[model samples]
Target: MTKTTPQTNRRIVLASRPTGAPTADNFRLEEVAVPALEEGQLLLRGQWLSLDPYMRGRMSDAPSYAPPVEIGGVMTGGVVSRVEASRHPEFKEGDLVMAYTGWQEYAVSDGTGVNKLPAGFAHPSHALGVLGMPGYTAYAGLIDIGQPRPGETVVVAAATGAVGSLVGQIAKLRGCHVVGIAGGAQKCEAAVKELGFDACIDHRAADFPEQLKAACPRGIDVYFENVGGAVLDAVFPLLNIHARVPVCGLIAHYNGGTLATDSAAILRRTLTQRMRVQGFIIFDYYVNRPDLHAAFQQEVGNWLKQGKLHYREDVVQGLENAPEAFMGLLQGKNFGKLVVKLD
Candidate 1:
């Protein structure tokens, strides 16, 4: 049996930097002191933590917009935690909030970066995925950048993923025909049946390009770029004139940065087709509009209740299995948004 101390917080830390794909060995779990809560701070016990694609970037000391996670530091992520004890008046015991608490069972908050969540919200875990960062990303990028016209075709890969799933559903609501590209047959079925996508093509098929071409009859008006390798290559030739491309994520090439080369013909097509390709981070938009969060909280909540918006989570039972679940994420093993559960 394991011993526990009231002052000790269990956490997962970066044990090693991954060369390509992060392995179970990359994470190290240890018990450490519960950090001292300052006068305007609180101690939080994590409930649900989000594991996303961006965590891969933090594992290495790469020159990027966000700082890298040090070898010994906690793995960075979003957390839905309950306030255990608060010295801060803004929060009291049992308060829940959305925060960047990383991979830890307990965390210290000065109430600086943490956003207070609703008091008795059911499915608080939804705050970390849908109705949260990923949902916001799909909202901003698709509406602002994609701008799909009614009757136009919108294509997206990783269609069953957190962001991509919302993107497709939103496109359908906009009167645009949506075709999703996912890995396996199961994900494709879920995309078409449950998510209400017009059709879904499996990227793992022997002739993906052939299937995608068959799916998008009018060519793609809005291409929500998620997995950027062979899938991007297939979609490149199908983009119609004046197509809008929202560069959201590149999960396929994320394991190892596969900087692909665009052919001269494709470059020529960009000029000939007049494609508008834009890449954005959601932080820029949501920062100016706190109301967006409130709006999404209402809209996504209603959709879930009305059975319009559906989400699937690949939840792991223990903190010990988190590393394996996370590692499987980069490879498309997890069927939905990956989250770790700890009692």
Candidate 2:
């Protein structure tokens, strides 16, 4: 069924750059008239908006891989949206697409980077989570950089989260023993039981480091680094000789906290153990890689359909509540892949 276009578009724009943790004051909600679509452009109504940890880096003007969102710009993000009006030949009015339309209710795209969703694609929001960027991050980092061998022990922080959950599961598929580090007892339990992690330790516990060490008796062969602060400190000593580390996100220090990095100690470990610590952005693998996307979707998608993989989403309703939900994400209040459902 074709959808009617709304006259007004509701958007959450960056009011001011965040100094530390982003607050509600840093965002401004505005209702503006939707502009007329040009020829070859399609009007999109956002259905699901992804809120990820990487967006935290974009909030600041720090020297990073991608440029920061300028003041008054719509907060940048990926969205699963429906085409309401299409002048583009490739898309129809009722077609679903995965677009980088940010945090706005409606947007117009000329099919530059938009991907038409597969017909009967189950769980469209999975495009923003497990079957999308987060899933690719986990797969590329673990397989290419991590190089997990059979019988190796792999550990990942944020075990119940979007990327971490898949990291652990894929490691298991590669015949490695997978251990997870999560925030609370409940998340830890879910990680072990639901996600098929061999063991999961609670990071909030008093002796978190000790608990992690105990779980991985053979030492960590690969450490998927999502949280950098205390978790890295704990994982450091447990890393076996020649262990690989794929640094993805640092959610622990994203809201203004020092990463516990002793240059001398890190160098000492690097020299003595011959360990490899590599930082990678998923976009690097994704760019100009139709082969990678096909391989990932075929392998991971099959596993998901076969019940070998699991995903969770912490969805908050409405575009207006995005600021509040995003703030809670920085504080570890989100249970899984955090997304805002624009109603």
Tens-place lDDT per residue, model 1, 1-343, is: 1423258888999999988888888899999888666688888889998888888888988796689999899999898988888889889887888899989888888887888876556688888877789888887778879988889999988888888899999889889999999989999999999899999999899999999999999999999987788888889989999999888888877686553446676678888999998887777777776776567667776777777887888788777777888888888887777888866
TM-score of model 2 (CA atoms): 0.97
| Candidate achieving the largest lDDT | 2
lDDT of 2 by residue, 1-343 (tens): 4544578999999999888889899999999999888899999999999998888888899899999999999999999999889899999988889988999999999998899887767998999998999999999899889999999999999899889999999999999999999989999999999999999999999998898989999999999999888889889988899999999888888986764758789889977889999999999999866687788988999999998898889999999999999898887788889998985
Instruction: TM-score each candidate.
Output: 0.93, 0.97
* Predicted structure 1: lDDT: 0.85
Off by over 4 Å in 2: 1-4
Say which candidate scores most in TM-score: 2
| Candidate 2 structure lDDT | 0.91
Consecutive 10-residue window with the lowest summed lDDT within model 2: 1-10
